[model samples]
Target: MMKIRKLLDIRERSIRYGSVFRVLGKWPYEPLVDFLLVYSPGCDRKSNLVVSTGHKAGLIMERLPLESSLEHGANGISTKWAISNWDEWIYPDCPIEDVFVID
Candidate 1:
C-alpha cells in the first residue's frame, strides 16, 4: 500500500520594525483552494464528490498522523504549486473562473 503524507502545519513569524513587533504572517493561502471549490459554482459542480468528500474525511481521520508528521519536521504543501498545478487534477475542459478573490 502507498503511504500517505500530510501537508505542513501552519507556522507563524513575527514582523519586527526596528524596535517593535508590528505584524505577523498568517497562513492565509493554505485553504484558498478548498474555499474556492466550496464557493465557486463552476469549480464546485465540476469537482468529484467522492474525491472531495474522501479528502475532507481523510483530513479529519488522519489528523493525528498529520500532526505527528509535522512534529517530525515534514514540510508544508506549497500554495504556489497547488495553484499552478490545477490542471493535473482538474479536467482540462472544466470551466475555471478567471478571477477568485477573498474579502
Candidate 2:
C-alpha cells in the first residue's frame, strides 16, 4: 500500500512540475514519458467521451480502475494507461482547459 502511495506521490510531483503524463492517443511531439500513451482534453465522436492526460486527471483515474473504459466512453476521451480506480482519483495540476497543448 505504501508503495502505491509513494508512486502516486511521485507521479503527483511529476505532474506538478509539468512532467510528461501518459494516456491513450497520438501526439505530434515526443511526450516526456514515452512508455504510456499521451492524452489531451477532447471528445471522440465514436466513443462519446472526454479524455485528459494532465497529472491531476491521471491521478483521479488511478483511484478508480473499474470505471476506466466506461469513463472513456461516456467522457469521450482516452487515457494513456489503465488505472486501478479512476472514479476516486484526482489530479491537482490539471490545466484550466480540458486539453493539454504544447506550443
Which candidate tops TM-score? 1
* Displacement of the residue 24 alpha carbon in candidate 2, Å: 18
Clash statistics: count for each candidate: 1, 25
lDDT score, candidate 2, position 3: 22
Q: On a 0 to 1 TM-score scale, where does candidate 1 land against the true structure? A: 0.22
Which residue window of length 10 is worst by lDDT in model 2?
Answer: 11-20
**All candidates' lDDT scores?**
0.22, 0.28
What is candidate 2's lDDT per residue for 12-65, written digit by digit as tens?
Answer: 212221223332333422232112222333433222122343343333222222
Q: Superpose all Cα atoms of candidate 1 onto the true structure and report the RMSD in Å to 1 decimal.
A: 16.8
Q: Which 10 successive residues of model 1 have the least lDDT summed?
A: 14-23
Off by over 4 Å in 1: 1-50, 54-75, 90-103
Global local distance difference test of model 2: 0.28
